[model samples]
Target: MTSPMEMDKLLHVAQSCAPPEAIQLIVQVTEDPHTHTFAKLAEAPTIQKLALTPEGAPYVQLLRLYTTGTWADYLSMAHQLPSLSAAQVAKLRQLTILSLAYQERSLSYATMCEHIGLAKDLRESVRILEELIIEALYQNLFTGRLDGVAERLDVHSVTPRDVPRTADTHNGHDAVFGLLQALRAWRDRSSDAITALDTYKRQVEQKYDARAQTMQEDHAALTDALRNVAQSDTGMVARMRLQETYPDAMDVEANRRTHSKRRSKRTRA
Candidate 1:
């Protein structure tokens, strides 16, 4: 029999390894009476000398025995251990969510392996974490299945034919795996489209700005030429009016035009 403390330590180590069978075994031994007795014996001071014995029962069977025989008491005893590490707690949190989402008796080894592998990257891990949390909340708040006890809650087992071994990856959450993949792909495509649209918008804006600047320069040149023509025409009208009133003014204006024309020709030459 393992001491309560010893069981706790073993369970902790098992959880670190993230073996699916190990998790189920821990749950079982903690719930069983006969296993619990051995576990307690293992905790005894004299037996403690043999605590590290290699001949001890496999950890999973021990856990299963405890869980089956004394489920409630085993849970109470297990909870007495100091809390798990933050990372371990996080992993358990994910497991709890998956347990509810899949409606399984417990998280299977395949599912556990898939989750751990998928969670290797922080971004993907966080997303998986959130999905698990939401699934847990759904089960608890709406379904009233906090511990995954409902017989009908278990996910339907997939047929062997449905398995996609060609992908070269183990998929843990097969129920939602296809949807997740599609969503990720859509997000990537949408992001690329937005980037392309922004680039096109900048290019169009630059073209319009350059065209506007060219038009402004052309307008300024046309305005200066018009102003010069208007001034010259006004001077000609004034001279004509002065010539009608006095002929001598007309002669002076004529002489200025002849000299102005010569100067204009010389500048052009």
Candidate 2:
């Protein structure tokens, strides 16, 4: 299976070559299972230029049929347009199923039959529809079950068909712009949260530093008070020791002072 990228490159190479070769390549890409998208091919300048010519008109229409039209669409235009091969028809049917699945998960038998333009007879229509669905299952187009009793197709999942060119272009732009906006919003929110965290961290650090400084200052003041009390205690203790050692000398000094005062009073008398 060719990747979409390779298919796109092939498309450009086709358009660059002769007209006959280019149409052939385009048809192959349209029928390619992996080449499910067609907006780019349809919009290619070479294809558009060719489509303006008489010979290239029908082929361009065929590409559009595969791009946005269904099997019923082909049937309606079969008289005027080129017919598709068995594989291409099958793929178209599968693409139709995918489109239906996208619209609703539970598709009624009648609705699907009418959409695919199946047989009018109920029994024949159901049998053919079931066969197409089973074939699509093998192709991995979708995961679904035919609800015979309910007369519906219960779809679990489906590969998406290509978007119409107009819608594809518009939605592509919107999707890109929306993604950019979301990324910007996310960046802003993340930046704000980081800033708030840093601010809170700084506040906590400042508070801690202030508390630590206060503690140091109080410690220094307490140390100075203790040192002063220690010096005073040492001086009083030395004086106490000196008085204990000179007890008799201290008494003799006191008595001599008292006797001198008494003799001076007698002389005066």
Candidate 3:
């Protein structure tokens, strides 16, 4: 069996020319003792080109696929087929669907059949989807399954395809401009986040300020009430002084009694 790399080389050569020349080149390839060349070819390309030729017309449309061509191009190529062989037509149809699956990811059987103008009847549409998936699997063009319950194609992988390279390559100025635009977008997002945070901080500060003011008012009122109570009750001040001057309440009371007794004795004497 040819390795994937060898097949890639063969396909690359096959793509370099029109169908006739491409077919010839692939056929002419041979494996040598020292030289590296692919010997075998897939018949799909020849079939695809024959299918692309229309009946009663000199024009031969060669459709590019699985490389630089778009989904639309593949579909157009399939539509161009005119009374080709069954196998040839099947190859082209399956290839077109693989491209479509790669693009859409998931597509309903009915919708796809309608898009590709498959059989008009419902039963025929489902049959077509199942057959196409089987063909794609055999060709290694697509890895997908039919969802009978959902009436859809569940695609896992498809042959790699890429957009055609554009001629207008960007220069240093374009790169710089792109970078500047990205930076501006980031800065704008940062500014918005900062603004939202500032607004939240201000709200929190206002709540904290209001709570602190209320606490201060309560503290002042309680202090004033304690002062008023001290002024009205003379005993409270005396008790406080006694507690400060004497170690015990009994000692302070004993001193007061001694002074009173001494004043009485002097009067008596």
Candidate 1 stretches greater than 4 Å from native: 1-12, 15-25, 28-187, 235-269
Per-candidate TM equals 0.27, 0.53, 0.39
Candidate 1 per-residue lDDT, tens place, 1-269, comes to 23567666654554444344444444444443222223332233333332233433334223222222222222344443323344334434443334344334444333443443444335566455445444544433223222323212333331111122232222324424654675798799999999999999999999999999986885565456445645785856754555565465446556987999999999999
What TM-score does model 2 achieve against the real structure? 0.53
Model 2, range 1-269, lDDT digits (tens) per residue? 23677866976685686668768866787677655667667777787787887778788777777766677778877876666776676567766776787657899888888787776467987887888788677766778887888888899987665555454434445435544675798799999999999999999999999999996886565456445645785856654554465555436544886999999999999
Q: Write the per-residue lDDT of candidate 3 for residues 145-215, one digit (tens) a residue.
A: 77878878878876643232321223223334544675798799999999999999999999999999996
Ten contiguous residues with the weakest lDDT in model 2: 167-176
Q: Once model 2 is optimally superposed onto the true structure by TM-score, how far is the C-alpha of residue 232 displaced, in angstroms? A: 70
- The model with the greatest lDDT is 2
Model 3 clash count equals: 0
Off by over 4 Å in 3: 1-60, 63-83, 138-140, 162-269
lDDT of each: 0.43, 0.71, 0.54
> For all the candidates, what are their Cα RMSDs to the real structure?
19.1, 21.7, 17.0
